[model samples]
Target chain A: MNITSAPPTTDRRIDVALPGAAGQTEAVAWLEGAQAQIAGRAVWSEVRLEIGAGEFTAILGPNGSGKTTLLRVLLGELPLAAGRASVLGRDPGAAKGQIGYLPQRRHFDAGIRIRGVDLVRLGLDGARWGLPIRALGRDRVREAIELVCASEYATRPIGRLSGGEQQRLLIAQALVTDPRVLILDEPLDSLDLPNQTAVSALLARICKQQGVTVLLVAHDVNPLLSYLDRVVYFGAGRAAVGTPREVITAGTLSRLYGVRIEVLTTADGRLFVAGLPEAPAHHSGRHEHDEQ
Target chain B: MSSSALPLAGLSLDPVSDFQQLTAFPFMVNALEAGTAVAIMAGVVGWFMVLRRESFAGHTLSLMAFPGATGALLIGLPAAAGYFVFCGASALVIGLGSSGVRRHRGEESALTGVVQALGLACGFVFLSLYQGVLAGYENLLFGDFLGITRGQVLTLAIVAVLALCGFALVGRPLLFASVDETVARARGVPVRGLALAFLLVLGLAVAATAQITGVLLVFALLVAPAATAQQITCRIGASLVLSVILGVAITWAGLALAYFYSEPVGFYITTVAFTIYVIARVTRAVIDHSTLLRRRPEIAEAHA
Candidate 1:
């Protein structure tokens, strides 16, 4: 089987029709042989994927594997070098209003004095000019905070909150817009294991209950493994999308990375992809050293 | 010496008479008008400048007023025109040269420092090149509230109004971009454009404030009130309003005291602003310590 091509047997490929027309299907995002380049170098090319409505998907890769590049392509921040990609049945940038996006986690300086609730409100009308009118969309902000289970400290200064608490508020901020598609970039990076699992479960529930398509980028696959409907693995200028079981096997991953990698299952049935020579041992270190 | 020529109306316990004495002369009235305008503009712009952590840039822009005034004098132009031209041009250079990303903040600070140094150097060069001794040179550095003309007050008022209008236009999106730039961009906020626009507004603010507090003590009106207000409250609206109130109150008090005593208005303004900042900071510390102490026992009990 050609691993580079789209999965032939899966029903996902059948939804690939017009670029900007999601006509009848529930496909929220569609990419056909899409390629993205950064600084004149192709980071990921020949990407073929279709994410349906209410589905929870994770984009996983080692550092410099172009997971973020792919997200930028969808957000319309970066132009696709070749092929076509669409979000919410429109061109990438055109459908931004319906797409809730959480950028990479950032530390709020302790001196930042804005209330957490105010931050959530910004997600609603932050793009609009003029001052924020009080009580406009207040209930929506409160509902979003309640949804994230962050109502306890929503009134406190955002900088004083813990990382997990801040992450929940940011998630609420993203959700306050009532987006049809939620794109979160490395939301679980700085959180502990329990918080990671909790946030992952929260995203999954949002996907199922609110019928919001969830696309999360992550480095580690274990916390999100069970909740993810599909996995889009990026490796050395290539991408593969399938169910976790299909795309994460040694045979598929080895072909994607062009190296002999091993997928091992622990006693608790948690799968670990080992033998990634290019992957950094300490992922956080890689982020810190990355040229901003 | 100048006060000896005018009636020495010292401040009294009665409030109405002190106000009457303060605004008795045309020059004093003009000083108050210009001070009020400058204080209001600085309070509003400085709140955002402090929030965005760009006080260095603001400081550098304030420094530009010196060279701008001197250069304008050398070329036989109005000092106010020089202040705006230099401050605005330097602000554009700093804003355009840096990406305003958090990662490049160190580089931004360096660029700000470079502009500040070059501005000071240009000021001294202009002073040396000019044939005549610069009249009111001390006023250029430490400010002369009594020297503020009615025309200057009008100019300051007009510039302050324009800056406030510009701020009102971009205030919300600017706050969003300042607080969280990456997500704001994704939400379709023009982050880069807002950064540039904010720098320009801040340039206007610095130029106006420098006329009152002078280049050396511009932070007296620009940063001190905003920093004090932010220390006291976390709410954006409350903090901003408090900043403006504190700024206006401080300016009035400073002007009154300078009128009563024989000192530069800048000295009194800086001293009062510093005192308020210290009080606010100490009060905030005390409250924070008490809250932490109160929470400790409960946290221990919960753990137990």
Candidate 2:
């Protein structure tokens, strides 16, 4: 437990040194003693964390445990109640163009007529006024679709595609801006097992090849366990951050949950948590009650 | 035939002569000009309104036209002024009450229904309080294209131009926000502001459209053509252009039919637009069914 305390003096020094440094090794997102509030009440407080550039991190927790809330705080949608937070060497939302975000899984209505390619293009310049110039941003849109391996059906209407295909195109949309930081919420919630693994591998590749910082929220972390550089687990207004080997152990999780718990490992090296009174164990092929 | 009934012109075999005859009257000329401007604006704005699935909100705004016009008549003002005031004000209320990324959609719909009910009630009250026979009351609900003056045509053109300019400024961002609001907001698009602006622009378009199609039949120019175009194409640019073309064609057809048959232009416009929407739907269904039939053999082979 090498948890750094409040008042991020080390982060301040790094900020001062950022101009001279190459910027690749800097912290992509820094949160010190951060408290998130909704409707004047604190959802979670006393959070201290720092994520370096290009690291793939997974946020795992039960429903209402503030995993999504932390992402929202970092996205600058929700203001922190107590502590300080910064991303990409600036305020939470000041450097938005350099960040790509995939929100919670949403099904496209069957009547939506926009093509998958156009939807991805919106991610690049949808905020701009006037009609889109067809020639502008074409190459990047193509590159993103190809990277996601969705070139075959990217021309089709988004509504007509299957869930997995739509998910891939949405990932392409998030990646179209060539962002340095990628934040996704429940990206794997409705995906099947095979699709879950494939999407995870794709995200891992993006992190390694592009050096993009990836912070994703998930319920079951098994699909992302092999690729994660670190894990942040939230429980009852508190959070624990460490490497998977350090954080997924019985001792750490039981202490975080304030209950007696067991971390069981399968013969194939998969880890699962059992003995939680309210929530089910984090197991594959079992559905957890969704609180969306 | 009643002495006051309009002299109906029979359709001649010569198309050019019929067009010349249709344009010969100043009132008909004004109606055609107003209809063209209204159609173009309605097509573009209505395409977005339908895309956002805010047609109900658009409908509520149109309903405001009734009260606006009658209230103006009661107060000794031009009905057009009433239309713009009531529609724009109600649009602001709806937009302000329900401008956010997600959630509260039920509340928005409920608010729209309430506004619609109040608008109708206000219209009836104004009508009863006027204490005079409001001649051409039927024309207020169903349009009176033949009664349009040249000044009214100019007003519609100006409003159409301004509304189209608004679209030019926010079209891309509006489309993005409408399609995926959460991601749009995450990417720094002002989702709430855009939503409110779109509602305001839709109010302007509705107010302008209600002038020609009247309150009850604004959907003739607003929803039907856009919906039909969407049903026919998946591409945004193509669908928008098609929607405009369909709207203009429907308006022209309704005008010509009304001139020849002595019927309300609103009824003719609504019928034409509805028929076109039905055709588009049927054609799409047929194409999809054939595609499925063609793919069945491959599925069977794969299974075997």
Name the best candidate (by TM-score): 1
Return the DockQ of model 1: 0.71
Per-model TM-score, in order, reads 0.92, 0.90
Task: Please estimate how well model 2 matches the true structure, expressed as its whole-model Cα lDDT.
Answer: 0.85
Candidate achieving the largest DockQ: 1
Model 2 TM-score relative to the real fold? 0.90
Off by over 4 Å in 2: A1-25, A39-42, A82-84, A277-292, B1-9, B292-304
Query: lDDT tens digits, residues A105-206, model 1?
Result: 989998898999999999998889876688889999999999999998998889988899999999999999899999999999989999999999988988
TM-score of chain A of each: 0.88, 0.86
**Which regions of candidate 1 fall more than 4 Å away from where they truly are?**
A1-25, A279-292, B296-304
State the C-alpha lDDT per candidate.
Answer: 0.86, 0.85
lDDT for model 1, please: 0.86
Model 1 agreement with the true structure over B1-304: per-residue lDDT tens digits: 3553667767799899989888888888998999999999999999999999999999899999999999999999988899999999999999999887877889989988998999999999998888898998988888878778989999999998988888788889999999998888777788988898899989989888888888888878999999999999999899999999999999999988889888888999999999999999999888876776676788656656
Residue B291 lDDT in candidate 1: 74
Model 2: CAPRI class: medium
